[model samples]
Target chain A: MKSLIIGIVAGILCTFSFIPQVAKIIRTKHTKDLSLITFSALSLGVFLWLIYGLMIKEFPVIAANAVTLILSLTIVMMKIKHG
Target chain B: MKSLIIGIVAGILCTFSFIPQVAKIIRTKHTKDLSLITFSALSLGVFLWLIYGLMIKEFPVIAANAVTLILSLTIVMMKIKHG
Candidate 1:
């Protein structure tokens, strides 16, 4: 139970890290300073985490990475379009 | 062997995700669009990951999150100073 709670808290904290960038990009419609390379690497990392979660059959990892992947991918796409 | 390799790869990938943002902030000397809230959350997340790694006795997680924390913290500081 403690580990689960810890995992959830960690998940929420880490996942929310990208929100500001996302919100900024959405509002400004600009990502000139953001890099494609970085976002690409991040998206790939999130994908791997998703796979790792599946391999380990861990629901928290799976769910967190899934949402993170979507959000990261969205930022990547926006950066590409607007950068 | 594969799991170890996979873990290392995932660690590197995820760790590198923030590099671009860090580089950009350093280069541009601007972070007006970046949010303090997001960076704080991210730094905290990295710290938690470091603690989790310590608790689990996982070197990979420890090493990765340590580097990530340093990099992310650098950006946060820069953003605060320059934003």
Candidate 2:
């Protein structure tokens, strides 16, 4: 129960980190100041974490990173399209 | 040695997940299609992870999430400013 709570809390906090930017982007449809290198690096990193999670059989890590990867990827795509 | 390697890999992977979005924002100065709810959830998740790491005395988790928090926050700030 404790671990589950911890996992849930961790997931929420980490996921929410990108809210402000996402909101701004949605509102203004702009992403010129964003860095492609950073996002690219970040995407790769998340991919690796996904693998790691799978290896360790950590469902929370895998699930969280998977969703995050998709969401982050979408934002990157939008930045490219609208930039 | 193995744990260190795992930590390093996980750190890099998780931290790098935001690279592409950051890069896009930097190059275009836009972020309109992004979702605030998602990012907010992600950030919160990471923050909680940081706390969890600290509670568990996991240096790798602490270091990785701290840096990630800062970088993610920066992107969010930029998105707001330029959007």
Candidate 3:
């Protein structure tokens, strides 16, 4: 039970981490130091994770990765736009 | 098997996604546009993920989150240093 709670907290943190990054990008309109490759790879990876979660029918995994995928894609787009 | 492969690939990509970001930070020495909150949250998040993986005795989760924790910490440090 403790571990499950820890995992959920961790998943929430990781999934929402990009929210500030998106805000920063929008506020500063700069991505010179941000890596396009990183966001791109993240988007792809999280997308796959989402798919895997669906295949396994895991609700937590699917929910977390779905949010993460959207966040990562947002960063990717911002990186490209600001670069 | 297919889902496992996809999961593995996703894990690998997400684990190594920070390599390019680290390289970019090192080369550019700029993180003004990068969000410290993002990296800090990511580091903490991945650390908890690692702990949860350990508790669950899952090798793949442990390995992936371990690497991700390290990478996210690196970014956090770089962001602080460069900012």
Candidate 4:
């Protein structure tokens, strides 16, 4: 139970941290200073994590990475579109 | 062994994904567009993961979260210093 609570808290923190970034981008529509390499690499990393989660059949990991992957990919797409 | 490899790969991906962001910041010294709330939250999240890893006595989790905490914290510090 303690571990589960900890996991939930940790998951929320890491997963939603990207929310503000996404919101900022959407509101500002300015990704000029954002690095393409960073977002691209992050997206790739998230993709791997998603796969790992799937391999291990971990629902939380899968869900977290799935969301993160989308957000990171959005950033990457925004970087391309806006840059 | 397979799970270990998967964990290693996942750790490498997620932990080091911040590198390009850090490098970009160092090179550009422009974080006006970056969101402070995001980094602050991320740092907190990584810190939790570090603690949870210690609690569980997971070496890989500890090491990975430790490195990620440092990088995320560095980003937060850089945001403050450069902002």
In TM-score terms, which candidate is top?
A: 3
Q: Using lDDT as the measure, name the better of candidate 2 and candidate 3.
A: 3
Q: Which ten residues in a row have the lowest lDDT in candidate 1 chain B?
A: B1-10
What is the C-alpha local distance difference test score of candidate 3?
Answer: 0.91
lDDT of each: 0.82, 0.69, 0.91, 0.86
Per-candidate TM vs. native? 0.89, 0.68, 0.97, 0.93
Return the candidate ranking by DockQ, descending.
Answer: 3, 4, 1, 2
Say which docking band candidate 1 falls in.
Answer: medium
Give model 4's DockQ, 2 decimals: 0.68
Candidate 4: which stretches are off by over 4 Å?
A: B1-3
Model 3 chain A poorest ten-residue lDDT run: A74-83
DockQ top scorer = 3
Question: What is the clash tally of candidate 4?
Answer: 0
Candidate 4 C-alpha lDDT tens digits along B12-36: 8778888888998998998877889
Separate DockQ for every predicted complex:
0.58, 0.43, 0.94, 0.68
| Candidate 1 lDDT | 0.82
DockQ: the better of candidates 1 and 4: 4
Q: For candidate 2, give the lDDT of residue B2.
A: 56
Q: How would you encode candidate 3's per-residue C-alpha lDDT over B19-63 as one tens digit per residue?
A: 999998888888888899999998999999999999999999999
Candidate 4 chain A weakest lDDT stretch, 10 residues: A33-42
Which of 1 and 3 is the better model by lDDT?
Answer: 3
